[model samples]
Target: MVYDKVIEIIKEEFDVDEVNENTLLREDLGTDSIGLLELVMAIEEEFDIEIEDANLDDIKTVKDVVDSIEKIKG
Candidate 1:
């Protein structure tokens, strides 16, 4: 599922020790713009789904990314 994939991407990209639904992208993971872009690209490649620019601004947390990916998949 997208949730699991997102978690995997976050863990791998940030080299985090752990990840949860509440883990924030900027705060907890310290991801900058380039990192965010990389994460988005990874998500797109992994899920075979494209995320729109408009929705990018609204994503601030790991849960948000998971939700957005699920919505796009749906």
Candidate 2:
């Protein structure tokens, strides 16, 4: 459910149809660096959490973002 919520946030920000485990934030979703940052900020605000810049480096796909959120939530 968290993953779905995260994906919804991303979709709402980027106006995308769907995002899956393999969806690359940049390539598949057409998100540039600035867009990614904005998305991250929006996610932080929506979830009321902070995602570190270092941790964000490891996030490449939708699944990775979801996993990061789960880790933070845990």
Q: lDDT of each prediction vs. the true structure?
A: 0.88, 0.86
Give per-residue CA lDDT, model 2, range 1-61, as digits (tens): 8888888898899998877888999888888878888988988887888999888778889
lDDT of candidate 2?
Answer: 0.86
TM-score of each: 0.93, 0.90
Where model 2 places Cα greater than 4 Å from the true spot, the runs are none
| Residue 29 lDDT (model 2) | 86
Q: Model 1: per-residue lDDT, tens digit, 1-74?
A: 77788899889989997999999888888988889999999889988999987787888988999999888878
Output the lDDT of residue 3, model 2.
81
- The list of candidate 1 runs beyond 4 A from truth reads none
